[model samples]
Target: MNIQQILKISADKLRQKNIPSTALDAEVLLLEALSKCADEIPPAPFLKGGVLANDAPRNDNKRLDKNWLYINNNYELNKKEEELFNNFINQRLKHKPVAYILNRKEFYGYDFYVDENVLIPRPETELIVEEVLKILNNDRREQACLFPTIIDIGTGSGCIIISILNELAKNKKDKIIHNAYANDISSEAISTAKINAKKYNLNKKIKFIRNDFEKFLNKKSIYNSNEIIITANLPYVKNDAYKTLSEDIRKYEPKIALTAGRDGLVCIESLVKSVLKIKKKYKQKIYIFIEADPDQMSRIMAISREKLANVNLEIIKDLSGKKRIIKLLYCHPELVEGWKAR
Candidate 1:
């Protein structure tokens, strides 16, 4: 059968089986099948097929012409094709995410290894990195000539924090993070983050700390508060939300990484209190940005303003205009007083 025929057959099968990305899924599966089998696919006229007549409508048939797909001597299915197709179907049937199946997730123009141990890096989280880099790059912070010291709280898989370091490395500016740090409550997560760091040669620039970030902050050693940028991608999915997750997600993914308690404010609340206490003792205002569930924006903002009364806080929206991030400046009470007195 030709490319168009296979796509129609596969997409219909996927739709019948309730796959979400039916068309896209079909394309991926078929393209991989062709590549694995060394099938010869030519840029011939849209090969007419039984699917084109009735079962598949002609008009919106995706217009997938010869130019769209690549087929060569590899077009014919082989033993490898069967294995690849079986693996993809089995994983998808289990609702495992594509990134996990591929063992890589793209973020900030780089790919990081991700598995069930850590939360999958989301495209939305890149906004936090973008904002952090912007603040560190062109602001007064840029004048110090010191490499930007960034600490990522709950740095699962080290994606967001490492991406910033990687981007800066290209400019010979990564030396600033000579003091960079990343902490996560899970040892597995810390290990995974370290792997990514080592793979990118960012091991020297990033310090992986396997500890509860909240507890670390509550410690007596508050000198670390001197970091200019503190970013976190904390667990914010609510307990009720957990009930709504697919069976595969609930059964296979890490529970600790997904659930954040009843109101989904456990880690966030602890973080707020710790940062507040640190700001009071250190008296140094530091910039902080964190990613959270859009639904939790009100709760997050309330915690921010209440705990950090002296600071200015704003909710950052994602590309879709949802409240996807929280940005805060942890200012000392005196800073607020000075501003008000002015």
Candidate 2:
């Protein structure tokens, strides 16, 4: 059958299964299948009345867009494409996420390799990257004295830290010296993250450590940098809430990357306690950006205040105006009051 006919059949099947984005999933899966068969596929069949005369400009690249499919709705899929597309549809019918099926996800406008081993990057998590960039760009201190180190705890697919490094590299005029480290407890996650880093030529720009964030923080080497920034997007889904999540997410994504303790604050609280120790021992300036469920922001703020006295905490809301990011600024005792005034 042709593109339109097959898409309708697949979409109808997905809709029956109650998949949220039925049409989109069908199109994307078909697009990927077509890309893989692009080399062996023949040209489009001749139209009877020059039907393609006013069609949108088609992209010659292997990954064709939805518009290309629209213009070629009558184009039939070859045997290989049909088999692959059917397999993808079957996976979706089982409630698997499209990202895992594609083995890729886009975050901060850059694509990262992903799989069942890592959590698929979410759009809300991009706020962490944006907040980090703002801190790096707004620093007025002398470049010579500022050795900025960015540590991403529970780095999963390394999307957060890699995107930051990619942005900094793209804007070369910012001459700040950057040291970056990413640590995760899962060896498979670290391996997956490394693949993404190398994809963007960032293997050397960021260090990947195969350890839990708590243990990784104990190393004395990270404290050498005077200016430290930490970005944590740890698991914050409560145990009960995890059960209520969509089947696609709960079934496909890694459980280790989701569903924290009962309160969903286990990971965040531990990280805060560690930061407190770092603050007490080192007089350097430290900034932390954490992404969490909007409902838990107030509790996080209270935890920060109780753990780290005089902490400058700010809550940044996502586009929907929900408090999704917690920005913590820690400075020397002398600078705390001044920092708070701003």
Q: TM-score winner among the candidates?
A: 2
41-151 in candidate 2: lDDT tens per residue?
675565546765124333354477787787788888889999999999999999999999999899999999999999999999999989888777654655436768889
Q: Report, for every candidate in turn, its global Cα lDDT versus the true structure.
A: 0.72, 0.88
RMSD of 1: 6.6
Per-candidate total of colliding backbone pairs: 14, 0
Q: Per-residue lDDT for 191 in model 2?
A: 97
List where candidate 1 sits over 4 angstroms from the true fold.
Answer: 1-9, 29-74, 145-148, 219-225, 333-342
TM-score of 2: 0.93
Tens-digit lDDT track for model 1 on 220-266? Answer: 54354334578988888899999998755786678887789998889
Error of 1 at 268 (Å): 0.6
Q: After superposition, how far is residue 86 of candidate 2 from its true place, in Å?
A: 0.6
